[model samples]
Each structure stands twice: as C-alpha cells, then as structure tokens.
Target: MTDAIKIDVWSDIACPWCYIGKKNLEKGLAEVASDEDAPLVEVTYHSYELSPDTPVDFEGDEGDYLVQHKGISREQALEMADRVTDVAREAGLDYHFDILKHTNTVKAHELVHFAKEMGMQDAMKERLLSAHFVEGRHVGRVDDLVELAVEVGLDADATRDALVSEKYVEAVRADEDQARAYGINGVPFFVIDGKYGISGAQPPAAFSQIARQVWAEHKEEAAAV
Candidate 1:
C-alpha cells in the first residue's frame, strides 16, 4: 500500500466555493488525522480557471461580472452572492464579494505552479484565495501577484521573474488539459486515490468518511495481493 493517500484538487483562485472547500478539506484532514488507522494525506492543488477570458481589470465588481457572464438578473446575482457569502462564513471565510476584483485567474494559476516548485504552494493558494475573496486584492496582475508571493516568503525577485517570463504558463495549461481529460467541469473537484471523485465543498465528516473508505479498500487489495 502507498504511504499516503494522494488528493488532487482542481480549482480556481477566484472560485469562492474552492476556498470554502479548501477550508472544509483541511478540517476533514484534521479529523481523520486523529484516527490511528488513517493513511497519511497528501494534497496537490491544480490550476483550473473559471473565467479564463475575463479581463485582467474588470470594470465592475463580482456581482456585475456574475450578472453579465452568468446571464442572471441583477437581483438574482445579489441573492447568489449573499447565499455564497453565508456558506463561506460557515466555512470560516470572510467573503467580501462587494469588493472582489473579478478578473482573469490565469496568471494567478501560474504563480501557484511557481510556488509548488518552491514548496510553498499551499501557502500561495491560501493567500491568493484570501486576497481575492476576503481582501479584495487584484490577483491577476503581475505586480500584485509578486507582492502576494513575497507575503508567502517566496523570493520577490524570483516570483516577479517567473510570472513576467511566463515560466509556469505551460504547467497551468497542462493542469487544465488534465482536468478536461478527467471530465471535470467544476471547481473544488477532489480526486482521491486517483479514482474516487468528490464534487463541491463537502462537509468535514464526508471527507473523513471517504478517507477511511479509501484506506479500507487499500487494505483489502493489499491482503489479496
């Protein structure tokens, strides 16, 4: 049996549920860690852009973007944002959709790839999500992304150079291609053991249950082998 259960998460930085899903997954991991028989957990975040064609500097706020892109009425957009805000709050995130800078997340995904090389991918992901959902920061711009990378203790110059040079652009695209191959059409999609697929921001208990089930299946296969 493998030493750890690998989890590959395909999500977008601008995705609010991705952030909430992240928090819930963390909670679930913590819960499973308390179990003596649980396998070690390893998570890798992959790039998935929900709005690849969005402008780097969108003129309006998140609601406007939703209304325009999602073909929803202005009132429906507000209601949707409010519903997500409450859900995010329950997951311990402070979402400020009113101030969110709805922009393209391709550059942000590239930065995440750079951080993964530097062993700071999780920190970079958390910072980027918070910057967008809670802090209302522009995550699409190179200068702004550089600042965020520095905040996570990555070298400022190297971060800037990587993004400016488009060093991780291919990595970002490769992840997207893989996502398509997996037939994943949504953010916060979790692939457990590279076989079981879990969608959406599931609660902590659900994650714990899945982890235990995977471990059990591994044990059964090992015994048969």
Candidate 2:
C-alpha cells in the first residue's frame, strides 16, 4: 500500500459550507491520526468559484443574490444560512452571515494558488475563509489578500507581485476546468486518492469512515498486486 493518501478538495473561499467542511475534514484527520495503522494523508485545496461572475463591488445583499440565483424566497435563504451557521458553530467556527459581503472570489483563489507555490496553501485557505466569513474582510482586493498571505508565513512582496501581475491565474483556471471535467456542481467536493468522490460538509464521523475505508481498500489492492 502507498504510505500516503492524497486528498484533492474543490472549494471557494466565499462558500460558508466549504469552511464548515474544512473543519469537519480536520476533525476526521485528527481521528485518523489516532489510529496506529492509518496511512499519511496530504490535502490539496483547489479553486471552485461559487460566483465566478460576481462583481467586485456587489451592491445587493447576499440573501437577494441567493434568492435571485436559486429562485428561493429570501426567508428560505435566511433559514439556509441559519442552518449552515449552526453547523459551522458545531465545528467551532463563527460565521456572521448578516455581515458577510459577497463578492467574486476569483482573486481569492488566485491568492490560494500563489500560496500553494509557497507551500502554504493550507494556512492561506484557512485564513482566507476566516477573513471572509468571520472577519468580514474584502478578500477580492489584492492588497488585502497579500496582507493575509503574509500573515500565513508567505513572502509579502512576492505575493503582492503575483497578485498584481495576475500570476497563477492559469493555475486557478486549470483547477476550475478540472472541477468541470469531474462534473462537480457544488463546493467542498473531495476526491480521495483520485478514486473516490465525497460531496458536501459531511459529518466528522462520515469523513473518518471514508478515510479508513479508502486506506483499507488501497492496502488490499496493493497486496494483491
């Protein structure tokens, strides 16, 4: 069996459930680590914008946008946010839906690509989600994103140059293309070892179970070979 398992995650920073899913995945990783025979796992976060065309200075409320896009009532959208907020809170995250300023997250994903080049993708992803959902920061701005990258141990000037020059734009686009090819229609989708697909912000126990099952199957396949 391979000693390491690779987890590819497709998500966007503007996605509230993505943050919750990330937390749940972390819980699952911690649980798996407690198992003596658990294989090592490396995670890579990929770009998947929920609103690729959203303007930088979006004027309408997020509830209005959701209502318009999904044809759901404003009340229903609010209820959905409340449900997601409860899930996030259970995962030890604070989500301020009322204060959330929704905007295009393409630039944020670009920053994630830049961080990946610096081997700080995980830190950058966590910080970007926290900044957007909890801190209500403007993640679309290049300067603000650079500041966040620096806070996560990335080189500030390099990140600034990358953002200014639109470096890694192709990488972000590549991730989007891959997501489309995989028929992913939602954020927080996971591909485990390029073999199994898991969707949504599943429970921690569910993630743990999948990890264990995948690891076991990989081991058995390797033994047979």
lDDT (tens digit, per residue) of candidate 1 on 1-225: 555788999999989999999999999989988887866788999999988889999999767898888999999999999999999999999999988998889999999999999999999999999999999999999999999999999999999999999989999999999999999999899999899999999998889899888878877877888
The stretch of ten residues in a row with the least summed lDDT in candidate 2 is 56-65
Candidate 1: stretches off by over 4 Å:
223-225
Q: Could you tell me every candidate's TM-score relative to the true structure?
A: 0.97, 0.94
lDDT of 2 by residue, 53-146 (tens): 8888777776887897779999998898899888899999999878787888888999999888888889999999999899888899888888
After superposing candidate 2, which stretches have Cα over 4 Å from the reference? 222-225
